[model samples]
Target: MPKYIMILLSIWLIVIDRCSGVSSPIKPFTLYKNSTELKNDTADLWWTINDAWKEITFELHIKSADWIIGLGISSAGGMKGVDIVVGWVESSSKVYLQYAVPSTNTTYHGKIYKAPTGYSIKRHAIAHKMLIDPKNVNLVHHLKLYECDPMTTLNDDQLPDGLCDEIVDEIKFCSLNFATVWAVGGDAMREFPEEAGCGIGGDYEIKYYMIQMHYDNSRLDSSTASIPSALTVPPRMEQFAIDSYCPSEVTRNIPKSGNNVIFALPHTHLQRISVWTKIIRNNAAMQYLFNSEKYDFNYQYENRLLKSIKLYPGDSCATRCIYNTKNKDKITSGCERTRDEMCLHMFTYYPRMNNFYACITVNDDSAGVLWIQLR
Candidate 1:
């Protein structure tokens, strides 16, 4: 996690609109809708974090499984390190509601990398260019780059430059802006009540808040989703959410293995009605940690065990998700998109195993390939 250390920092509360530069009253709650596609099936995503809005309710009057809806707090417009509560109605009529947050480490080309904070990335990139550009006198003075190295170069007066690069490197965006807090999901329609501790930093309190909604209609032709924040603030927790599977793009059968399972949530699209995570030893004896026989798509929740189960490194762990296919209709399966069925068990284990909390068994191919034989 400590791949890079970002040093100098200051808090910046975004009280005014980014575009309009006009200030609005800090309210107890806010609601947002996608104005671009207003006629779609999604509902307005709402959230609150004020004195009176301890218990925020989220209601979706969805008509079909044509959309994916979720919301949470974040420091910026992006999803990294955000605390999100997302849900979707699978084509199989199963509904799933989950609380999820993206890790700071992003996966790309089968590699993990850390991205800088959005503000820092944007601000420094501009500062870097202006420092090198001799013509940007206004920018140099505005950023106080002139204070670093005001002496003109002996070669060319116009070619001379302030220590803009050095000044930019000396300052950094606020570290507190990333604070966030959220819960996954429950049978209740409303979000769990939470206190408003957006930090008590007098005037410099971080103000940027972000909420995003994603709707998936890949199975069909289309979809839409919403929320907004003037200031960016991160959650206050630092814990890892890990999953045990194969390496990225690598597909391997679940060999006998064992580990303590603290929380388990079986994930599969609508084609599944039942899913199970069992610990198998010697390829014979089996112990179940999670099982959903009559699984409903709308009420998927993280089934946390009262105690962590013991698993052996040599013990094989298997996941079985059953889907209903009348045979009279068409069958869909793939690695990406909802039309294709998936079999994955999202688990949070105790006693950290490796730096990589989540493992991918199959890259981006049809896990449904295995489903074919199981069916």
Candidate 2:
């Protein structure tokens, strides 16, 4: 080949090799403040390489901050016999240490290292602590070998049950941002506590849970039954109210005797029901009796006459009533005193201008009658 062509080919090969996973020297990482007045105290480190290198090292520089309290590593595939070297600079001197983490059979491994030196060593491993001043630290570097794949032949059975449990515990303790869990084998099941064990008020309580089950659909046998069903709160309990409608569609008749009373109707619908009270005094004519001039009337063919009380659909005996006037006056005043006293009725309906009405009742004699007309 021509001399120039040979040189160009060599350069291209080197570039390709690097791109195709050639191991290289340690990469320098840095942390900086967004504002000079406010400090950034959090950081994340990620290691991603398919091949195993001769040695891996991490160097850190921090200023005006406390020591790094913990360290963690996650294996996307699987890793074994991994060794790490950590080093730091303190009081103008360098401190370092080495540690090994056994390959986890299930999930990722998290280890914490305490300060190795009385003055807070600059670097340590597994569970070690390192000290650095936020203003003085300047350089952080990671060095790793780049030659052999460390996670190519991992299998599910190689993982330990405790590994998965550990992962869950970490997620619970550290408040991790994201997590993913997978189940292996046909018989394995994942479980979590229904209530947080801390016994605190803000603790998480998992009432209803759903999990996706995945298997080879084609391999499913016609005779093979599905996993037993789990106990779940009824859909009606979650999405709809148990007692949605109040004063259920029963009739209520206010008697001639004035009395303070409270009424309630059960509601099951998840929506809010409006309960209204209407006084229909015995006028010479029904039209004059319901006219707006005599009373602030909002009478609907179904449940409009009584406008203040609302009865949700699922409520049961959820209605309430209280008489405001004295017994003799209430029975004798406003056309309600005669054999046909003013009829006080209660109705429940939605807020729409003309929605389907749910329940209504008219007062008769000394009692009230409630009726459910929704069918």
**Which model scores highest in lDDT?**
1
What are the per-residue Cα lDDT tens digits for candidate 1 across 21-102? 1122232243532111112433322223233744334333444463565555444545454556666676778887653422
lDDT of 1 at 350: 39
| Residue 206 in model 2: lDDT | 15
Off by over 4 Å in 2: 1-48, 51-61, 64-70, 76-89, 101-375
lDDT of 2 by residue, 1-375 (tens): 111110000111112222122122333353221111112332323222223652223323233222322222323222232223333334444444323223321112332111112322222111212232333122111111111111222233332122223544422322211111221111112122221111111212211111111122222223322221111112222121111122422323222232222221221111112222332222211121122211211211221232233333322333221112221221212221111112222222222211232344333455544344431
Relative to the true structure, how large is the alpha-carbon lDDT of every model? 0.36, 0.23
TM per candidate comes to: 0.35, 0.14
State the TM-score for model 1.
Answer: 0.35
> What's every prediction's RMSD, in angstroms?
23.8, 28.0
